[model samples]
Target: MKTIHLGVFEVAGPQVGGTLSWPHPRSRSAQFHDLDHWVHIAQVLDRAGFDFLFFADGYGYPSVAGDLPETAARGGINFPSLDPAVLIPALARETERLGFVVTSSTGLDHPVQTARRFASLDHFTRGRVGWNIVTGASQNTVAELFGHTTMQAHDARYDQADEYLDLALRLWQTSWDDDAVRADAAAGVYADRSGLHRVEFAGEHFRSSGYFTVDPSPQRVPVLFQAGTSGRGREYAARNAECVFVQGTTVAHTAANVADIRAQAAQQGRDPASVRIMVGLTVTVRPTHDEAARLRAEFEEMQTDETVATLYAGNTGIDLLALDPERSLEQLLDRDDRGPVGQMGQSNIDRFLPKDGSAAPTVRQILDDLKGKGTRGFQVWGDPVEVADELEHLMDAVDLDGFLIEPIFDPADLEDVAELLVPELRRRGRMPQEPVAASTLRERLIGADGYFRRPEPAAASAHREP
Candidate 1:
């Protein structure tokens, strides 16, 4: 058995089903649960041996088909905007070991602001915070907020984000000394003035001319996470990210992706092992195989088609609500072939349908397979021992660092995993029992017991191993 890290994506509000008219609020506690309900749930995950609670956020709802606000309002989907990073401090207060990862797009805000916010979070949490780096996917986000009529070209956005990251790196990594902050009550000074450094950067997309206002926090920088899987996105992750998130249906596809990413990391002059790749997994565990299958069946029956459709529509950028059932996914493929989503158009289709076999799955088929794809990273729905066996197989096959656990149900679903699945992993010597030390997020991720050290290279190279 091998050790693996695990994370869960926690969304605000009730989860939407596949279609608009279908049941939008799928949570049984929709009537009783609110935002704070999620806060308490975060606390639960922290105590349940989860490495982190990763949150997926969006500035605008799925409004590309027609009017934006109307669709969001009618569906009651992701409308109310609450910056997920703001909620980290609250969660940090409730637990000691669990980490927090929140999405913040390079397109939505300036690098200075992003740098300041995440740096503050790292400080507040004592280093248990990660930024899920994203370039906004919607055109409406810019049009409504930034007064832009259309989105920048996909490749162009990545280019801008590249510069944005460079600027942020300057602020977070190069701006202050490790011992810059010296709290000396006798000297009546909190931070040593001489230890501060200024970074001067001028780029096509972003520019910074002064010293960073904040001193270096624990970990110096927050743990970096990237989800895009395009060639350009992979290169960006190789150069900048500590963790790369991948999603796919089959183990072979995921293995190929992991290999590709590690190869890229090696080329970037960084230790390939330094870049931890985590794939999303959805698990349904019970005491016995029969019980687990029954629970999985119950979840599939409860899944809402509309909710899944809304999510798919948002990703493919073709409003499934507006498309005819006969139209092929090939028709929606962008000619320029850029952006993370555009690059993944075919892969996403393949995850739902057959590759070179079907044009694309129907809207209903996509919703029907939601559970399967949700577990595409790896699905383990069975008795504790059976699920553990599958998990070990996946780890050996892909050399995966861990899984991004997506609970098909609510927080209770997490409790079930904790009760049934975690112990099995521990029994197999695949997961640790003791909570990680109260340390920085980076420290917890790659440290020994909970201490930081310079990253080391992988044991074998692409050619060396193969």
Candidate 2:
């Protein structure tokens, strides 16, 4: 049986799922700016035998509500964010086994800088690093932060990302030969110059002509993660990603996504199993089922219609405030006849629209749905055993490799999972009996055969006898 892999999801800001979470009495989100807070969480998760800590990031505050930053800032909706790359080294130093996955955008960052950062982080973490590649999703972010006068069309962004990954892969894989470094003090040689090669790449979106400066880290390349679900996005992931993050409102929806992505991988001449699918999950657990229900009720009460609207606007680039809440979504879609507009627009549509393509829901219905569940993925509210059972059921039903646990609030939500949930999972033999012995993140997540294998140098292959 496959050991169910686990990871914790977070953002380097006060809020995670929605704005209301930050103000909860038990929440320590206010301490997000403090280094000790992150270090403590890292240690806690490391002790709990988590596979990784996945940090989601964004470039700008939410603005789709009024095309202004005030709503996001006033609500503290994903504002006051910090760069995950800056936090990784500190967390890495505090933990030995837990991996770290940082979200970086292909649209805003240069491949050279991104390659060097992840390469250095892989070394610092002893091969426990993964990169979540995002094509910048927010139009406000594109205009205000990345200095783009206009957002690129959805498919065009993926086309640029294709070139971005091509350059990054060349830098990671071919720039430094496996045996490039020879630190011999007596010979006074730090590196063999002949083993290093320069990469000259010129594409429609990016151009670079240089050798990578960092030596190969333990994994050589950080484990590649992608969360895009559009046709172009899936194609890119199928060709390049080692892991894919997906969110769905139901088991069948998630399962179908997994099947589609795997088929895409096979079509790209890659092993479908090599790419692990991690579903998003949220849990609110207590010692008893009744108590858990009470907590869920309280959480639901804290949510508001405005928070739901702002989140929707931020994600889809569609201002829900301007639309009549009483009208059906199909009516609005037909009247405007506008397709998905942002990078994440299609995904947001998929999340909100009914699977059967029947009559569309009203704006009020959508908000009510979000209030009940907040966002996608499996949501469980129960005692530890019940939570574990729900997780197991979802894993089996969807054929998922793992879950990225979304915290209702930082530290508190995660602490509950570590203390209450993990033990139950272990008791059921759903978790590993011992810590994974693999030295690298890729191996730990998908076993030894799941890592990237570079082609052998021609000279080295020729020297070996048949």
Candidate 3:
């Protein structure tokens, strides 16, 4: 079996994103812009041997209730959303091995700029960079800002994304031969004009004339990541994603997702094993079970049910606040299947305890679960050994490549895991004592060691310019 890779998802706040169970009215009490915390966390992850730090992004805050804009802004609910790419350069300066992966929506950004930015970061990070691709999900937000009237249909968005990827690949891979740049100060020449080629692309969604603004970085194209299990989404991942992030509530559900993507990869003539599937998990680990429980309870008390409902409303595009308290998810699903909240209901109803034994969990339960001090992803609370056992169980049950671990409250969460849990995992033969090697992100993850090498300088042509 291949060594399992690990990653952590960053949800910038005092606590994880999602709902809280605390009863007191919530406020913007948490400090959001402590760059020190981010830098410290990046160093910890590098020291802990994590594969990457993945940041999930959205273009706009949740807009559901008539008072959403004000409510979200005032409450600091994902309000200080900063560009993740900007943070990577700082993080890259602090750590050597940990990779940086960030989400950028194709729908919201121009392909030329997006392509150049990632390439620049890859160079800055020395190949430890990845891109998580997403299409814009909120139309109201886009319409308000960019003059768009609406979001594209679900399937149509994927269609446009396909063209966008094709254009990006042509610019990154085919635009210039590998040896285009030659920095020879003696001759006062930089590029070999013969080896450079321009890529002219025209499609329904985008048209770009490109000579890649940035030279090929350590890895010409950073590792690609996609998070979607829909039919169109799976097809997109197979052709593009090196690793796919899956969000589902159960091992069984995630296994099905992994199978679907692998099957899709095989159909595309790509090795099914080439695509690595990682499930989301939030762990609260300690020295003893009792201590873990107490910590969890504290988190629970700080969260509120209303917060959960508000968040659910924004995610599903259904105002859970408007529905009757006793309404079943069966009722909601019957009305619409256009968004993620509905899909979460169908995909994860069994993992949660139903409020009245007829539908989804109550807003209170959602808050309670989310607010638990060491909660997020798939919650498993225990001692180091216990946590290791659970990790093994998840890896086996879900057939996962590894986990996208979310720190309960801070980066210290990862530090504890590394100190307490990593040793136990190594003793059990689940993880390696020494890292494989420091190489390109693809080499590190895919075992494609010899596949990548620095390109030789392109030959300078001495042509008659007279």
Give the TM-scores of the predictions, in the order they appear.
0.84, 0.93, 0.86
Local accuracy of candidate 2 as per-residue lDDT tens digits, 136-224: 75555556665666667788878888777777777887777778799999999999898888777777778888778999999888999
How many steric clashes between backbone atoms does each model show? 14, 0, 8
Error of 2 at 356 (Å): 3.9
Tell me the whole-model lDDT of each prediction, alpha carbons only.
Answer: 0.67, 0.78, 0.68
Q: Model 3: residues >4 Å from true position, as ranges? A: 21-31, 69-75, 137-139, 330-375, 449-466
Q: Give the TM-score of candidate 3.
A: 0.86
- What is the alpha-carbon lDDT for the whole of candidate 2? 0.78
lDDT of 1 at 386: 81
Can you write out model 3's per-residue Cα lDDT over 374-420, one digit (the tens) per residue? 22457778999899888888888777888888765565567777878
lDDT of 3: 0.68
As for candidate 2, its clashing pairs are: none
Record all residue pairs in model 3 with backbone atoms less than 3 Å apart, i.e. clashing.
Answer: 20-303, 20-304, 21-303, 21-304, 22-302, 22-303, 22-304, 299-373
Residues 1-466 of candidate 1 have per-residue lDDT tens digits of 4478888865554442222222423233242235576676677777767789888776655555444535455555454445566678888887878899998888878899999998899889888888899876444444466777666655676788877877777677666767778888998889876777767676777766778898877766778899877666777778778888888567876787788889988987778887888888778787788987976676566445454555565554555555455544444454464333452233355454445564567654455666324324556788888887888888889878888877655656677788888888877777777666647677667762422222322321111110
Which model, 1 or 2, shows the larger TM-score?
Answer: 2
